[model samples]
Each structure stands twice: as structure tokens, then as C-alpha cells.
Target chain A: EIARAAAALLRKVKGPVGPLAGRKVLITAGPTHEPIDPVRYIANRSSGKQGYAIAAAAAAAGAEVTLVSGPVSLADPDGVTVVRVESAREMLTAVEAALPADVAIMAAAVADWRMAEDAAQKIKKDGSGKPPTLQFAENPDILATLGHHAALRPRLLVGFAAETQNVLDNAASKLTRKNADWIVANDVSPATGIMGGDRNTVHLVSRDGVEDWPDLAKGEVATRLVERIAFALGARDA
Target chain B: EIARAAAALLRKVKGPVGPLAGRKVLITAGPTHEPIDPVRYIANRSSGKQGYAIAAAAAAAGAEVTLVSGPVSLADPDGVTVVRVESAREMLTAVEAALPADVAIMAAAVADWRMAEDAAQKIKKDGSGKPPTLQFAENPDILATLGHHAALRPRLLVGFAAETQNVLDNAASKLTRKNADWIVANDVSPATGIMGGDRNTVHLVSRDGVEDWPDLAKGEVATRLVERIAFALGARDA
Candidate 1:
């Protein structure tokens, strides 16, 4: 009995299959839209393929995953609970509702700003030939908010830095600024063909150092990321 | 013989059901992406549904349509030739290639700027945690270029004004600036539900004046616009 107990503890600490069994993971994916109006919105070029892949991998790893997704054309992954939303504000609310998880990954490309004041009616053209000025309001930073939340914060907080330049430095800064344990940074320059593409090259940024990852399919990246998360959390239930 | 000749000319003026038969229409739709690097890009929220609707309507009206589209999830409309592109430069090139048309509609939300300098390799984080500064270069104005083209300019140069305020004024200004014959101005304020929504409210601004149109589905709008184009061209073939 003593040997068996020791072996079980070792399995909990070391890498083990089904390490994330009974673990609750929270993930956000897709592009958060900022409404310019009821029919129009401010959005990004995120296909949500990466985030969706991660959610599926987490589920496959035996985690109960809640994916807070923005509007996209993808079908929901099997064995995961999905909360669909349109705007950044709605995404934030949905994320907050799925809190108190073992891990929280902020992977969605949330719009930075939204129209400060949306017109009530369809704006009409006046006689003058000048353009109207648009005022903007900053959107909520979901990763930062949940990372530094006073309560209901996840045990492990991870964020993503999808940048064109300064991938590592930007991701490292995001780790500190967002109070995240790790950041998965990827370059999205057009030449790389990663944006809206299936393959990605990633760099894992943490306090210790940055680990460069080779280019792989988004699905493979997701599996590796899930493995890392499981190793970090140990074989423990949330 | 004289009466038959007169009727033949009259058929040319009236929409013979397929008024646009053999007429080539060039259109640009969706949001143009501006790449920051190999994997990241700067883009906007444009569903490409409006443009697709226009293409479908144009095809239904017996016009040979070439749609220059950006990255969007929606499938290609039947009977339309779609030329898919990623960045603003690619879109501009594609638009130029599909020229010499009777009507040209610039409907894509082209990105204004792109990273002036893109890193050839994935940037790594040094000891310093500062983010890299990004410089921008302006993208070519597709509407202005085609509208003001010395040659190969479409008989009906139509441009869309997606504005938040001063809808009429901005649209009128766009007509003069872009040298377009007509401007279809629409307000994208959030309450209007015209942005990604199927319905739209438009103001047709021409040299005569602004004609305010009530909210209608994109398909209806397309039908009306095609009718107007047919009337303007007198059933002429390009």
C-alpha cells in the first residue's frame, strides 16, 4: 500500500497520460467584434482555427473545457462546452461566467476599441461633403483582467501574443503586463502564411526563458500545448 | 424595317431581362489584410456578404462578374468568378487584372496601412522587454485608382462609402475625390444593424443629389442597383 501510494504521487507530479482528467480549463478563441452598428463591427483577421484546435486538444486530454468563442464559421469541437458571443464585451462576460478553472488561456484576438457612441438610427448624408469623425473607447483587456482578478482567478493563466514584429519581446512583456504564467507568441507576417493558415511557428515565453518551437500544424501545436499545461498543473483536479 | 430597327434600339435601352448579358462587371469585396510578418496581419471586420450578394445579383442579371474577394468564410456565389486575395497589394493587382468592364464596384474594406518593415526571421526576445515599434506605409486606394484610370475606366464608376458619421457629406466627398460617377453611402452605426446584417440602408449620391433609400435586404439592394446600372448604360455591352 505504501509503494502504491508513492507511485500514484509520482504519477501526479511526473508526466502521465490522462493527466488533466477532471481538470476544468477555460479558453477564449476567435476575433472579438466591436460593434460599429447593429450590422457592422470592428474586427480582426483571426480565423479561430488555432484557438479551436487548442480547445479540442484540451478536451482530448480529459479536461472539461469551456471555450468562449467569438463569431466564426467553424463547428464546435466535440466534448467541449462552447459559449458563443459577438463583441469583446460579450466575450468578457462569457469568460467571467466560466471562471474558477484550473487553467485559463486567452487566445482570442479581441478588438482594441469600439465606437464610443453608436448612432441610434442609420445615419443619413447631409448636404455637406465632409466626412464624419469617429470617436473610440478602449475595450476590456480580458487576459489582464482575469490574470489579476481579486477572486475566481484560475490557477494557471496563459495568454497569446500574435505579432508581426518583436514576437519574443512583445510576448515576454505581455507575460508580465497580463500577469500570465506563459505566453505563446507567433509571428503573423504575410510571408509566413500562418494567419488563416493551418501551420504555425510558436515561441513559448516564460519568466525563465523563451523556447522556440518549430513550425507545425495548428492541431499538433494544440496537442503539445495541452501537454505542457498538464505537466504544469500536475495530475490534480480543479 | 424602320420600326424593327427602332425597337431593336429600344431593347438596348430597356432591361431585356438580361440587360447585362455579355457585360463584364468588376467588383472588390471583403477586408484586405495587411501583413505584419509571416503569420500575423492587420485586418478588419468585413463579412464579404454584401459584395457576394452583389455578385450573385449581377450574375442573375446576366452579367459576367469577377469578384476580387479578401479572406472570408462565405462560399463563392454561383455563376461568379472569384479571385481570392490576401493583402491590399494583391487585391489591387487582382482588380487591375479584371479591368475593362462596364461597371466597377469597390466594396472591399481595404486596410489603410501595413508594416513598413517586416522582420525576415521570427524576432526573439532579448533581455530587454520592450515591444518592437511598428512603422506603416499606406495601401493603394483601389477605388480612386480605378475610378480615375486614364483608360479602361468603367462606364459606371460606383464606389461605396462606409461611414460612421456625415454619411451624405462623406459620400459626396468620396465621389469627387475618387472621380466616381456614383457613391452608395451607408452608415454603419451599431444600432442600424447594417454592417454584418443582411439588411442595409443606403443613400445613392450622384451629381444630381442624394437619394435616400430605406432599409432593405442585401439581395434587394443588389437587384435595385443592377437595375439602375442597366438603365444608366442603356443595355450596352462592354
Candidate 2:
């Protein structure tokens, strides 16, 4: 335990060598599993690849990063603190707790709805073939919550819009609705192979305009996004 | 292609050594993903560990094994013909295709219901606070289908009953309702940690009576089950 503390202290005291050296970056990633019962759940197809890559890039660039992740088969990125959560509500709570950041990226594909009332026991099929009617409850929107925070809101908030149709228009609207500085939008239609695939083709939507980006590896997209963030921050300071 | 064919021929010609050498066993394992949309799905907590273990054990006993599996991260077991599938309907189709076996085990946690009509586009959240009303359609009962198959019904049919309450009673009812010879029943309450855990404590519910099993590793359970299967088959032949 002592040695572990010393290692953490060393990391805290490491030299300020990168553009984001003093920045605290908070990121959310993966698909939240909303319980319908003790055995079954509702889930999305986000693989957490892009968000994990971004976290790794931020850490490499000397940022103090906190990643609020949902259920995913992924290892924690090096030099970043990761808080694992299961449901959208839990992810929101974790994201709120890691507040007062320089930048916050809401990259997780959060479930839009959860069971109105999760059953304690597994629901069995009655002899009759009639199916159950599932009543859904809207899940807490993590990005909007952070955007509307009275205080401790990140200076530059980013949100992701994964859409099956009208990707750019949906992303542009999301930027205004969520009060985010930028909305990284992508076509996640099944045919695109983007939901769980490593390669991503994203468009940057902001107040200025939309910039269409070519297809690239998730890691490359992270690197490019980080560079743009640094430039944007430097311009604002100037 | 020639090398592969030669390898297959060699396996086919290998001396009949183990007790199950001349037998053919059919198994189904894992959780079916019932799609709600292109991005979201309904899933269960089954990790497919127990069923995969049984497949491996059966193959080791020299049975010609065919395993129909749902979405799982496990690698295919050595010498087993694995058929991968996604939804409950698809799984039923695959199981029907690989029929006429000496023994059949239905271990998959198939979805009880799926969307009545899957959305072609990603469902958008309207301004209203009210969530969508999901209409479910009952999925096919793979175990019951096999049990009622007139011509291709296996000599020994095994089903699994994963219950959070009334473990024994549920198993017994399932045996009668599904026309299964045995039901490997287990309590999968979150507290039990058996759904995704490496260990299991299962009860064998048969016509004779319920046999309580001690907590054992999944692999050990598979081994013992295979031994019982061999003995039962031998006794029947005698």
C-alpha cells in the first residue's frame, strides 16, 4: 500500500511536458446495461474503443484524466483513473462526481430508456403465449446534466451523436440541445460497421460549422481530436 | 483445403476408444441478443461458461459433438463443430438443422421475447418525457420444439432451468412441460454469482428425484455430467 501511494505521488509530481499538462479531462465510454430483471438487461453496441483511445491520448498528453465507463470488456487505459458503472444513472453520478474539469467528453452510448420497474426475480413465461408489455422510463442524460450544471461544469464540453440517419443534422441539433461546444457525429447504421468496429468516420459539428473527416482508426481519431482541442483552448486563451 | 479434408478424415478414422466414441451429442449454449434497434439489444447475464464446459467434456469423451452457441466471447472448443447464432429464432433454426443426435442438451438462456417490429432507423427521443411503449413478441421455445419432434427427438434430452426462486419446483415443472428427461436446475440470483461465475451448484431434476449437487467448478460439473451420461447410455444399451 505504501509503495502504491508513493507511485501515485510520483505520477502527481511528474514534469509538466505536454499541452494538456495542467488540464483535468473527464471522459465517459461504453454501453450502459439497464436491468429489466436480475438476469436480463437492455444494452447498446458501443465497444468503448473510441472513448478508450481518447482517454489514452489525453493521459499521454499529460492530462489528469477520469474515465467514467459502463460495462465493457476493456482494460483501463494507462495513467487514467477509471470508474466503472452499469446503468445510465450510475454513469451520470460518476460523471458528476468527477467534475470541475477543463474538458469533458461524453462518448458513451448511454441507454435512452430503462425498465420502469426492474423485477427482482427472473420473469417466467406463463403457459399462455401472450407476451409481456414492457414499460420504459427515460434514463438520465449525462451530457445534458453536465451541460446544465449550476457550477463545476467543464469549460469545453463535447458530446457524441451516434445516429442511423441524418447524422450531421442530428449532431448539430444535439450540440444546441445539450449545450456542448462540439458534437462528434457518426453514422452508426448497421451497414456502416461503426458501432463495434475499430475504424470510425466522424464529422465535427460546432457553432462555426461542420467539418467532414475521412475514415480513420479509432486511435488516430482520438489523436486528431486532442490536437484540435489543444488548438481551440490556446485560441480561446489568446 | 486438401490438408483440412485429410485432418477431418483422420479424426473420423481415429479408433473408437472412449465410452461415447460412437455417439453423437447436440448442445446449445449462451444468451440470445434480442434486438430492440440497430444500436440497442436485450440480453441476459449468461456467460456460456457452463454449456461450453459441457461441450468440451463431451468432445473429450469421443462423442461427435455439435454446439449451437449464441453471442459469447469464448473460443470454440477443440474438435467440436460450433454453429454461431444471434437471435432466438436463428438459434432454433440452427438447432433444427443439426438434429437426429443420441443426446441433446438445451442450455442457452434464450430470450423469452423480442421486439414485435424492429425499427429500421435508430429511435429518437422526442421532446416528451414519456418513454416508448415496447411491444414484445414471444420467442420460440427451442427445448419444447426438440422435445416434441416426432422423428428426430434425441434418446436423452436435457434442459436447463435457471431460476432466482423455486429452483427445484421450476426444474420439475420444466421437465414435464418440455418433455425433457433431466433438468439441470440452478439458482442464478445475483447473490449466487453463478450466472457469470466460474463455479456452479446445480441440482439434477429427473423423473426419479432431485439430486442436489455440491458447489463445483464449471469444468468439474461438466466432467461429472458426462460420466453420468455415459453410464446412462450404457445401461440403456444393456
- Candidate that scores best on lDDT: 2
Per-prediction interface RMSD in Å: 7.4, 0.7
lDDT of 1 by residue, B28-123 (tens): 888776655443455665778888899999987789899999988789998899999988999999999998898998888777555677556444
Writing each residue's lDDT as its tens digit, candidate 1 over A1-238 gives 9986886686578633365877899999998766544334455668899999999999878788999999788899998999999888899999999988989989898765666776554333343533344466667789989988998778889899888787788998899988999999998766778877899999999999999999999999999999999988874433
**Where is model 2 more than 4 Å wrong at Cα?**
A1-14, B1-13
Residue ranges of candidate 1 with Cα displaced over 4 Å:
A1-21, A31-45, A60-62, A84-97, A109-153, A159-192, A200-217, A224-238, B1-17, B36-42, B111-139, B235-238
Candidate 1 docks with a DockQ of: 0.15
Instruction: Give each prediction's DockQ, rounded to 2 decimals.
Output: 0.15, 0.83
In lDDT terms, how accurate is model 2?
Answer: 0.92
lDDT of 1: 0.81
Total backbone collisions for each predicted model: 20, 0
lDDT of each: 0.81, 0.92
